[model samples]
Target: MRRLRRLLLLLTCLAIAVPPVAVYSDAVAQERVQRRTVLDLLFGGFGFGRRAQQQPNYQQRQQQHRPQTRSEKPKTKKKVPPAIAVPEPVVVAKLPDARKVLVVGDFIASGIGDGLTEAFTEMPGVAIEARTNGSSGLVRQDYYNWQTELPALIDEIKPAVVVLSLGANDRQMMTIGGSKEKFRSEAWSKEYEQRVAALSSFVLEKKVPLMWVGMPAFQTTSMTADMSAFNTIYRGTVEKTGGTFVDIWDGFVDESGKFVVTGSDINGQQVRLRGSDGVSMTKAGKRKMAFYVEKEIRRILGDAMTIGQPQGGEAVSNLVVTTPTDAADIVRTQPISLTDPALDGGTVLLGGSALDKGSGRSPRDKMIQKGEFAAAPEGRVDDFRLDKRPQPIDPQKATN
Candidate 1:
């Protein structure tokens, strides 16, 4: 019945849509969800195989991956797909024995720790480590000096793969130490952004493989725009720095350019993902996102997954235990997927499965503007910062 409904909806999407890019409906906010996972979720183990058994709580399957740099960084843009916009460090030979996977980010990344652990635990030659702080972002005007932490962590772990997600808490009005400064002001915002860019540059210097997750497809345009701007910078810096830039905006978005969270998740439950409060990922959201990461990792190192097993690629451990205590919590699982649609190259809210857009007139959609804007490392510049930007938009450039 649910599958039939999805089919009907897709057909409706094709028939009555004013334009593929300009879809808007109150019903879009309400739909069923499914539980899903592309691979296994093991915390730590030696073997790899799917149980191929159904659990009590059944759900459907789904999932979603980065950006930008400087010399000290190499010139990345080559006037084409291979070209980049920033400079990056050189890639060095990694240990053929096996590689260490290190993850870094703010709260959203932290929340999904268990799922990530499970996803990578059983791989023969792979060891996974997760480091995350709740209140961190790419240090700039609005939030904490998240940049300072990354360098130190990188030095210590020396990880071959870095999965990073943050920058939500950092969105705020900036105020200077002694004076009133803000992030909304161009001067302050650019300054704060420069610091953020600097940190991205530093990451590029290490030449370590980094995956910078973009915010998921958002329900509101205001928050969505902010994230989009951030993504521009992230991609520019990460790609320029010789790191992989996964354009996640397309996978989770609807033909109308909004979040489609409802009919998306596995269990057909109302979605709590894509954009948690328009800024975070729910339990379902994070695990789904992790699957995308797993897919990319396996593709990059297929043969090396098992140590010394030249051709027996079957030893590959795709899913590990992402939830620690829930080892026996036989819930449904699915891939980390999102439509990631780029509606006229706009920003995307992360975490929603491919079916859910997670858009509506919730508290977040109002755009809390009671706070002051300034020129300090906060979004404190009030002169130019309006109380709000645009509202929900018509998707003039949405694609299926």
Candidate 2:
């Protein structure tokens, strides 16, 4: 029993000594050491005497205990290309006597003006003056009367050509003889026709060539149908009043005659022509619409629409007057008939020469004079000769 007690005391002493030594070793190594109990030491628990398994490295312990995060690749920025610059059209300076084209009407007319300006931008002899009220129409004289305003504009601008593009906003009620007439009714149509004629006649009286640009098809079916009817009325009235009607229906429609948002441009390239609202025009649409007007204007203006002129010379009219030194010095040639044989450098007409009885006339001459058909060429399908023998091929011709 004494030996057992001594053994117990020795174990207790060993346990106490082992802890202090472990603490000293931990301190020397600068590491955390797990303290062991005396019972564990006596029972020979794991790592009882060996330096408490050197606590894992501080950095390694931190890394092991830290939460895991998703690995993400570094983000890189994409390179964007620089925008290309578009060149603006160069407009030449207009002469003091440059002819003016007065464009008047509603919003569509304003778009036409914009397009015409671009169209004639380079012409020094032509100028465009657009006088438009966006919401004005023939029906709303109370709002704005074109008849009253047109005379003043003509006198003020003295345009060489008067271009009218109206009726987009004229689909509402109209007042006639102090009575409101519903749109498109018989009475309304008469009044509208009269108004168109009156406006056109006023321009005609002023001696300005009137160009009534007809309405184009709209996006809405009803609006397109209304425009078609309006165009018809415009064509009839304007033509009756000696004004030129420009039909632009085909430009804004597809092959099936339906309204299109995109269509061929002035350059024949496919492009967006109309706006989202379906009433207004995009830039391309404006340009295309102007194309129809431009043709008529150019045709009417003729030589007045020449682009560039001699830089430092005085502007002169096309007519040239020259004084001859003497009347006798003037040389003149007699006018000859278009059918004169001299025109072809021949004194005799075709088959004019008399043929000898021995020299018979050709089949062509007989066919021309007697309405007889010339013989068909040999080997031709029309050649109905009884002989059907195959001709031998020429070796040289075949080789060639």
Candidate 3:
């Protein structure tokens, strides 16, 4: 029984030793697995570093892939000079030696005539005949067509010079080939230009010197703008046609280009330059308009020295015929081949002879004695024809 107890105790001790050895073997196997995983991580990290070092940078790759362009200097802006306006040369008539001036246009032209009359009153030799109609323009042919009437009128007057100042009423529709066109429209503008050119050409064809006066600005802004545009067209056409375009825009406008009703007169006195309506001019304003034109006339007349002097070396005479003479005799009486100064009664040629101190009281005196001639009747106060009957205007004819 003692032997059996010893063997059993020894077997129990062996079982305990075997279990500890198995536990140690398991711990070692787990340690080997952990070491293998660490080695794999370190190798993979080295491989990634090598690949990164071998790769090219983005900028380097772009440089290799993209084509290069030659370097160029930055461009600089060039300075340009402002344009200066030069005055066009004036074309003088060569044919007729008559010194008579013919004025035609709208109401403004009547004012020009009045102003010229007053200006030339001192110089009795210069004659000014004004055929201005208030309600006249290039647009309305049914009323008074300047394009047609002007040629006939020129034939009747046989003037050495012509002055035109219409367009005030021309900002209206035009009838072209029975088709009505709106003013300032492409068609209307073209047709109007053609008409203006025709007038200018007609005057030039007659070898008559022409002065085209531009319209002044109105109190109405749109009117002012239209006038400005018309002036541009006039300036270009007149210059092209060898006519002088007189600009009176600056005279009626202030420094800022606004219309001024009052301004300094030629006499240096402050006076009303424009009428109450701002579209028309006052008496002083008319005189001012004439002032600009007079300068040009003087230049054409050889600086005013030859204004009273007869052209073609003909003697100045004051002879008068008591009896009426035939056309041939009348033509013969004008020995100067220039003009019939006697047309105005101020410088009538007497007896087809040279100026002599002995002529039964000069023609001017004779007219005064006979009471046949008198100072220009005082102009009607209502110069605008407001007192006259207003003609019916076609609405279709109305424009800007």
Candidate 4:
């Protein structure tokens, strides 16, 4: 009986010990699992060490503010200003004669106007001056004051070639003082013809050769027709005054008389010329415009400078960045190209070595190609933009 009691007690102790061990084993397993999960969140692309946490919110902001064209216009009044007329282009006051050139027109001329001016740096001794303000025209306006501004522009710039680029805003209804009605009837048209005649004579008197740039077609067919009428005035003025009238309307307009954004440029590459904003120039647009201007200037230069040889060069700038914190800072550098493209959608190609079916590589350390491309596996891309400028765009640059 004593042995039986002792054995029973020993069995009870063993059972108790086994239960505690099982419990401890389960606790350890749970701890290990929790640690692994935290590590995954820290190191994985799903969340990870530092910047990974903020990526989701950044992506959300991009999706929200993307080029969906939400019309959140600031409140503005509709009172048309009276001091409206095509003024002479503003110049940099003192550039060499080789650099002295004129730029003219309305808001469209002024779009990337600063950038357009910068493009003149390609020319060794060339300079660009422009004098277009808001709502200026050669003839026919809803209302404005050309009398006050145009003469000053002419006298000050005294440009070698006066680039006249207005007429988009001339298509509007306004008070006709003599006829006492809007400029639609025969009388208004007659008065309009007279005003055009006066403007032409004035430009001729200035003795500056003029380049009459016709308006590019707009989304609205009616506006296109209106621009055509205004261009007729421009053409007539140029013809009568012995000025060269380059029909850029065709440069930017389509066979349907619509605004064309696609074509092979003078550089032997297909390109688009319109911005997404409906009435502005894209980078290609700006470059193409500069190209046309360059053609004109080159022709003029041929009259004076001797051509020895053609040369090419590229400009480069680098930024060295360092922060005071973090033991091992990851350095992710993206190159940027001022003149090329990057990103098709969500994919990325940093260098020529990384381009897949949807992308082409760049040498700029900017992404020449990257993004989600469902359309062209190898065709012309549409969604390329700047990595930082606007499109989250990878630019035409190197990745490594």
TM-score leader: 2
Query: How does candidate 4 score on lDDT?
Result: 0.60
Q: Residue-wise lDDT of candidate 2 within 1-400, one digit each (tens)?
A: 9999999999999898874433356455554455678877788665554444444455578988887766544557888888888887776899888899999999999999999999888778889999999999999999999999989999999999999999999999999999998989999999999999999998998889999999988988998999999999999999998999999999999999899999899999999999999888999999998999988777767677654666565433332233476999786554445677457555533445643455377877878888888778888999897976767999999999
Those runs of model 3 whose alpha carbons end farther than 4 Å from true positions after fitting are 1-98, 303-400
Query: Residue 54 lDDT in model 3?
Result: 42
For residues 93-179, could you state the per-residue lDDT of candidate 1 as single tens digits? 334456777777777667445456665554546666788877776544345565667788888888777777766665665555545
lDDT of 3 by residue, 284-373 (tens): 989998887876665555433244444665332321113345655654433332466555544445454456667567658969788665
Q: Score each candidate by Cα lDDT.
A: 0.60, 0.85, 0.76, 0.60
Clashes of 4: 28
Q: List candidate 2 stretches off by more than 4 Å.
A: 1-83, 307-377, 380-400
Lowest summed lDDT over 10 consecutive residues: which window, candidate 3? 314-323
Model 4 C-alpha lDDT per residue in residues 67-176, reported as the tens digit of each score: 75457656588988798688765433333455456676687676524445655544445557777765776444445555556668878877666666676676645446
Error of 4 at 325 (Å): 71
TM-score of each: 0.47, 0.61, 0.52, 0.48
Give the lDDT of residue 107 in candidate 1.
Answer: 73
Give RMSD (Å) of candidate 2 vs. truth: 14.0
Which candidate, 1 or 2, would have the higher TM-score against the true structure?
2
